[model samples]
Target: MLAALIRQAQQAGLSPEPGFAPKELHWLAQLHSGKFTGVLPLREGKKGRQVARCPELSQPEMMALPRVLGQTQAAHFLADSCGVIALLPERAGQEVDAKTQAKHGAYAALLERAAQDLPQLLPVLEVLRNPAELAELRAELAQRGAKATDRLSFAVDGLDLLESELWYDWWRRFRRQVFGQPTTTGTMLDLSSGEVVTPAKTHPKLNKLGVGAMPTGASLIGYDKEAFSSYGLQAGENGAVSEENAAAYRAALEHLLAQAPVLGQMKVAVWFDHRQAEGQALIDAIENPATLTQASETFSWDDWDDTEAIQIVQTPEQQAAVAHTRAQQLLSALRRGETPPTLTAQYFALAISGASGRAMVRDWHTGSLEQLAEAVATWFEDLAITNLSGKRAKRPRFFSLLMNIQRPKPQSTSMDDYLKPIRNLQLPLWRAALDPNAPIPFSAVAKLMEAHKAQVMTGQFSEALSRDGDGEDKSRIYTRMALLKAYHNRKARRQLARGQGGFLMSSSVDPHHPSPAYHCGRLMYLLANVQDAQGSDVNAGVVQRYYGAASSTPALVLGRLTRLSQHHLAKIAREKPGLALTLERDIAAVWSALGHALPKTLSLEEQSLFALGYYQQLADSVSRRQDLAAQRKAAAAQADPHPATSPLAETTQTEQTAQGE
Candidate 1:
């Protein structure tokens, strides 16, 4: 990761070499150095005195300072910056002096040192020479928005002093000469750069830890507690990062924190690097995954000035199809072994979470672009489901897919334990989507079942049968169906090792062969349809009351439902004989496949199959309705002046679809 960050810095034309820092740090260093020259305000008593045109530190140019005890460093505006009394060594919240001094010569020596080092610092020296002059300078600087605690610098010759290479070099030398090596004893291994170098006392704080965190930032390598250490190494030495390498890595991570988008509590950053290092365009494309699908939408043709013209515009559906097409193309390239070294890229992703005043490393992954593209292609393929009209389902956003498995929130403010179970399910599911070979979590189906039961009971079954409804409602169904499919397909593969599984399910219901539970699910759907055919109010329908029981324990619920559905079928036949026969035929086909018997109870795996079967049967019912409606329209259009619309031609349609399908 450090190497990648260093590479990033170099690619952006930034030099974080021995004498130079990264761009932001360089700018900050310049803002605090004293070589800069600009308009300098005089003391309050000297208000009529012309503003000095010399090196001067202003409060607005300052940054947060590092804490250093028992040492004093004076800025260009030494007297102008108040709060120096607290930093003076001779004072400890005591009276200022016996008689003459209000500040008791506070920070006097520190100001004098600056004057002795450079005569250019005369303005500050003059102010410190007189107590009244210092008081006035403080008052004047305060009125101009100067803060006593802020680090101060100046603008010299129309440029920042720290921007001068001479000042950076001088400061580096001064620090080494004055402080010596931080670790007095021995050299240690630098983990980030993989070299032998003196380790730092602590890694620099990750600048701007921006997940709604305190700006004071966090430690990436902390060994403050004894249990956190090993082999007698103390503090950050346990991680053993050299001060230089630590700074570089922190800068890089800070860059990502500023750039990556945060979703929920996960902070994610991604980058694609090439071995030959010539993939700027590829990196740009990889950064915006949506662009992979909707390039024309993001890269507009009308606004484009490229030599090649983009003349065609595609609809959202077409954009989705195009994404799959591109994914497949990438896979085919790998399969054909047509990829060159230039086509190869390395992908890195870091998932971070900030909590407890520290940056937590949640996940770090590296993969080849080819592998990622193939996995993504398979992801979309595995997520595909059959809609109510027996057509392919559109791809769902990852966010919506994860949200479907999550239960509704608690009313109470406290829910930490409740959220852990949900988070456990989410992490593995996310990994499964990325690495196709990774197992779907063992808890996935069970948790989804829990959420499914809640949905059925809460009257949120907006599209329980039709499969496709309106926008967001349809998306939820599609995501649920996709997650179900992925889990089952993976479960089936695992079962193949025991010689207990043979094939995946088709998009529609299979009557030739199926588990008993699946057949039970089909029975449940038919019973719900029976209720609808009789125009019974579905507010307390068969599904609303008994879907959970019927799916898990068929013997207890199926028989009672069958008896109730027969009564419903009798009523439907009286009103619409033709529609009733159609319903009876559908039920009979499923029963015949079940060998005219119901299972006593279902196992856990069987329950999943039951859910899928119910969804499939519901979709088939919707397709049949659509086919019937189309047929009636055709007949009405061709018949002699519509022939007064005979009752036979006008078989009653269930306006009250099952569960509001």
Candidate 2:
């Protein structure tokens, strides 16, 4: 049956090559001789006999048939066609020859069968099955046979065995063979022209099968072993090499190259463990100097002009021009009584701005002189009432205003105690006016004028009186007035003396007259009456000044009272010689109180002088009183000659004289 099938296939234009051997032929002859049955049927149900077997053979013959065939052919269609007879195992050692013949024979038989069954397969068969008709096919098969000398080669050669519909269609159109011989494919084929050239056919199965035109001695051209290993390909694996793996490797290479530009420029010292050939290939492909040059050309400045220049130098004349322009603008604004935007403008154009430049503005507005004056005047009026009480006045209102005005710069650090309160009030008021809502009291304003008067009295006053000439004049004037008022009021009040007689006698002017300290108290009383009658004139500087002066009178009067106490002690001592002892004790009590007050009252220089005089006078008076007391006691003890002559009476007279002395 196999021989008859071979003959039938050959008759139908299938070519049987001489590669067939004795064993394969014998296998076919046995089938023709009815020595074996075809295949066994497991179940007895369907067609013909109850125990179905080959029609021309017995059960034993059919059983022996499988044993006669080799495992390779037994698994394939060796007995089905004579064209495939050469593919059966004829000799144990000729594996390569047998396998190649088997593949070609199978293709021949398939083509012939296809031609007979489907007329559409005729053209493809004419080109592939008959060596006489398709010389190229015969040559390709021979080339494939020569190449398939090893396992890898055989696997590659097996690619031609793909007998699918698309392969047949490709065969019909191009009449080209790519199985063994190097024929055109992949960009080389002109499929549109129907030319017998290699077509660019990316065969999915061929790629998956890893069947290339030839075994690339070192694996498919750019196959990455490591990548293939990731896909389960190890050192030794069975079956055909997967074309999918090859394609995957190619795709991976393309991806790497696409990312090369960015990676190449990265400052990473990449290292890899690869076979020398692979490493070298990667280095050569990625480290091309030409690529770097091309990349760098993208930013080269070929069209730039180096000779173009710019001038940076500023001339003295130009600078002077700028200064003059600024000066003129500032002067114009100042003349309009407008405050300059900045201190620099104010200072440079002060002369041209007139009084406006020097005018006191609030400290919140940068503390100009005008604002300080206002604050001082306001605080001075507030301080007036306390200073008039004929008691030592507590200048708490002045201290509070000073604290407010000085803010960050303490007044004590910058001004004398006499002038500090007034200056402090003025400075912050100047700052306060910069913001309209900021407080600027009438008392501070009044004190400002008084401070001006105080400045006039002090020799420390500046000659820069005109605000237009110098920016500091108004500040200086305000400072001076505050100092002058503080000093004048302080002196005037000191002239009034409070005593048992309502006021002390002033012996310097009139021995029997009341002291200027007493008069100061009267003046203060009169000023209080005037203030009570007139409502506080918030705008009047004169009212504030007089009020400040009158208020300070009591402090002066208290100081005079202190001095008067010492004076009376001296007068009593001079008037009663016998009472010197009593006088001395009273005087000592007065002196002790004065000693306690003196330190606080006197300036450093005055304190030293006064302490020295007080101690000196105290020592002299003590010594003289002691001597007078001793002399009187001695005389009383000597003899009363008239001795109603009680020793007790004598002693009593002596004691009385001593006590008087």
Local distance difference test, each candidate: 0.56, 0.29
Those runs of model 1 whose alpha carbons end farther than 4 Å from true positions after fitting are: 1-167, 177-186, 208-215, 227-232, 275-291, 294-343, 389-394, 410-420, 462-474, 496-502, 506-513, 534-540, 634-661
TM-score of each: 0.68, 0.16
Candidate 2 TM-score, true structure as reference: 0.16
Tens digit of per-residue lDDT, candidate 2, span 433-534: 122234444455444444433442342222232113323443333332232333333333334432223322111111122233323323222222222212
- Write down the RMSD of candidate 1 (Cα, Å): 10.1
Best by TM-score: 1
